[model samples]
Target: MKAEKNAVLTGAHFIDGDHAACEGAIAAGCKFVAGYPITPSTEVIERIALRFPLVGGVFIQMEDEIASSIAIQGAVWAGKKAMTVTSGPGFSLMMEHIGYAAITETPCVFINVQRSGPSTGLPTLPAQADMMQARWGSHGDYEVIAIVPNSPQECFDLTIRAFNLAEEYRVPVLVMMDECVGHMTEKVVIPEADQIDIVERKFTKKPPGEYKMFETNESMVPEMIKVGDGYRMHLTGLTHDERGYPAMSPKVQQKMLRRLVDKILLNEEKIRHIEEDEVEGADIVVISYGITSRVVLPAIKKAREDGLKVGHIRLLTVWPFPEAYIRDLAKRVSAFVVPELNLGQIVHEVERCAAGHAVTRLVPHAGGAVHEPVDIYDAIKGVLEHA
Candidate 1:
């Protein structure tokens, strides 16, 4: 019997990483982009600003990150797919609005071309250091969808997915890319415009007299009505009821809050995405994502060559954390090795999911550059031998 081809074929493209991300967003039907230029991420905005006008799109270089994020939300509320590109410091400034978007259920895309952190640790250097921050940086208990692309092609592909997911869920989506993938050149084949699947937000169909902005349904995502759509809707950062009016009651607030979190949490199966390898009979599993996962690939291969039963789990969806998959892997693996460009962010999640079934270890590295494959190989070998 002949082998069947996988439905999702993985391939790489040779193109400037930032340009690829920009081109991908354009191809994905993004009509509005608002951002403040920051290092590493500047290329993304630069390309978007140059090309947006050609595509009948609006690209604004706002006064600052806060205004940029606000403009993005405004564009989405106007019924257009909008995005903002930024880095660490700019992302810090956008946190409040990120929370606002969460509460308002405004669907927009945020591209964070990550650079060294704390406070501009290394602008040109790559870092997976923002993983935790991407998930928790914004205040509050809302769930946000963040996609980490390991390459330029993924930067493009996932940017499209981010927009699609944003519209489908009516929540803000993030394209989390690091300096290496953002700057590296790779060959990418972009599909024809008609070949791509575009998802638009579910607009309200009820008459103006019957519309309720925050009303929930089976999906928990309310039907959105744009400003001029003849529906009188009120949007607020404060906890609100179905009428979109501010609610002071504790029960209303709790119900609203739970719905906000539940919408994403309960739909984990649809939102969670991951890549797993060699786990049928593995004793060691290396968990990684983004550019850091690129380093992990070779290390896993070397460990296998050295006669160790090893495997890997790469997360394409960074936020919402793919806990179920991790927990399942934890049950079968002897140890979970997590490598990232930070002291210990994702490792905490891995440890939490692994529980007592497997030992979880962190191979931490800070910004200047990525962890060498040899270091990861050593960690994998050490864990396997030690275990």
Candidate 2:
């Protein structure tokens, strides 16, 4: 399906990442949004509140993050694509419902415009600290797709991708943007409605009496029916069988959990998005994501100028971690240098995947700012000396 003509603001416009994300959601057929206004991310909902009504959509400023998170799920069951936006602190409040979304197979987007934090840290500053939290913050074992964007243009592009992935996988998809990207202004090209592809909801084709809410075949994703569609639906957070009713036994628990995790794990290659350059026989590969990906480019250029064999890999999709790809790359590279806004979050995933095949070094930062080019350069040179 294509975007609605009215929703696709078809032309080039100077916009910030927050506003671009709002336009992206609208372009992706998202008709309902429920979010609380939080720093760095508030502009997203603000634009949605203003623009949604014009597109026949609804934006509600919920009482809190908790309500906002679950409200989007309700909207999904009611037959509309939906989303919620927040920064780190509000993201923390939404974790439980995130788990609920996963277990119930609700397709929705969660935009976390990341800010510095373990608590209510610097709300206005950028941080990539939530990379780990987005995947592991919710309790229990479930999988989700997470994508990060470095620029306002990509902020628009990837948010549409996030919504598409959510509908395709029937999992909560996250658009992880940092404060710098969210607030930075850039020229964004909004293509025509026909140029934008949309993944419509997979509504069940079976008649009401023949439909089973959570039934699936080879795709590992079940067909969905809206709340008033004459189908009986019973979705719960507990372990369940093909039917969406609760089944508390261990066998049902194992089957339910495996399906939820395997659907993503099995289709990982299709979901993985990373950009690699000059990695062939390179001694050091710099791994980074989000704003840090943009920040580390100069360092990479400097390393190449200094006669060092260096390459770069920017993670466009952070969750699922691209474990197999990193494991393969580790076999050829001498070391991997990970630079993130957080002290050491994604670097651990690199180290684990490298698994002694190559040295994994972390150029850590404690948030509020990005790493200097010299810092990343020094790590690259240091890895060469040690390796």
Candidate 3:
């Protein structure tokens, strides 16, 4: 659906990443948000609690993150564009619901402003440790979209992109923000309502008695029908048929889970987004995402100045994890230096995709703060010295 004109904040404003994400949701036509306030991410729903009402939207502070996560899915089925906000601990609490959304194919968004954590480890600090958890937190086999934003502007832009993808794929999309990006303030330029591209829910064209809730076309994305629209639907976490009925057979299980994943795997080319630079003759490429992407740029430049040809790939979409791209690039590069806020989350993915073609180096940090670019530069230098 096109964004409501009144909800569009079409101008420049200096705001924190969390607040900008709130406005981004508004511009993307989100009418309902349910969140339980948590450190470093509270400002997102705090802004929503105030601003949502002004734009004919609603924000509910649920009893806890579990309630907050599931509440948004209920809103989605009621034909509202809905989302929930949280941090690391809350993200852990919401894993079950993320699975619910995935199995039910509910169109909703989860904004996790990540903090250092095994369990409330550092509530006010930033961490990218949840990258693997975001990909595989929920139980069962399922694929979900996760987007990473490095700057405040990207926090705004990518949040809208998160919603559009959730709508387009009929799956929960994760806005994986860390504490640094969420709390950092910057100038965010929001465009006019008309200029924004929105992907509305693909509602079923069938009449009341003709629709099958889980039936999908070639896209593997089924058309949705809101509750109270005179269409009967059965939804469960169990393996079900296209009509949404439970079938306990192994074959039914295979079919349901396959589509749950294939819808994303088949469209990897469209969903994957990566930014690359200076790779034609580079000996090593540095891969990073979210806030770490910005932190690594100076190191890349420094290495280049020292006559080390280092390329960069700032991952925009982290989940359908740019496998083919990395595999192809590994054929040319001698090694990959991965520096992230975590010890070594995504570096493993790069290693796996490199397929023994290139050396993979991990420059790890144990959260709370960003990486020093010199550390990254040293890693690049060491890799080249060995090569």
Candidate RMSDs in order: 4.5, 0.8, 0.9
Candidate 3: where are CA atoms >4 Å away? Answer: none
lDDT of 2 by residue, 1-387 (tens): 899999989999999999999999999999999999999999999999999889999999999999999999999999999999999999999999999999999999999999999899999998999988999999999999999999999999999999999999999999999999999999999999999999999998999878888889999999999998778688888888887888989999999899999999999999999998898879999998999998889999998999999999989998877999999989998999999999899999999999999999999898898788899999998996877
In candidate 1, position 23 carries an lDDT of 77
TM accuracy, model 3 = 0.99
* Per-candidate local distance difference test: 0.85, 0.93, 0.92
Q: Any runs in candidate 1 off by more than 4 Å, and if so which?
A: 1-13
Task: Rank the models by TM-score, top first.
Answer: 2, 3, 1
Which residue pairs show backbone clashes in model 1?
13-186, 13-187, 13-188, 14-186, 14-187, 14-188, 15-186, 15-187
Residues 1-387, candidate 1: write the lDDT tens digits. 111122112244567778788877776678899988898989888988887767778999999999999999988888888999998999889889889999999999888988888897898898877777778888888999999889888887888889889988888898889999999888777765556677867888889988899887798999888888777678999999999899999999899999989898888889998888887788888888989989898898888999999988888997888888788879988999999988899999999989878989899998779999999999999985676
1 or 3, greater by lDDT: 3
Clash pairs detected, candidate 3: none
Most accurate candidate by lDDT = 2
TM-score of 1: 0.95
Model 2 / residue 295 / CA error / Å = 0.8
Given candidate 1, what's the lDDT at residue 315? 88
lDDT of 3 by residue, 1-387 (tens): 566788889899999999999999988989999999899899999999999778989899999999999999999999999999999989999999999999999999999998998898999999999999999999989999999998889988999999999999999999999999999999999988888888999998899778888988898999999988888777888888988998999999999999999999888889998888887788899999999999999999998898888999999999988889899999998999999988899999999999999999999999999999999999999986675
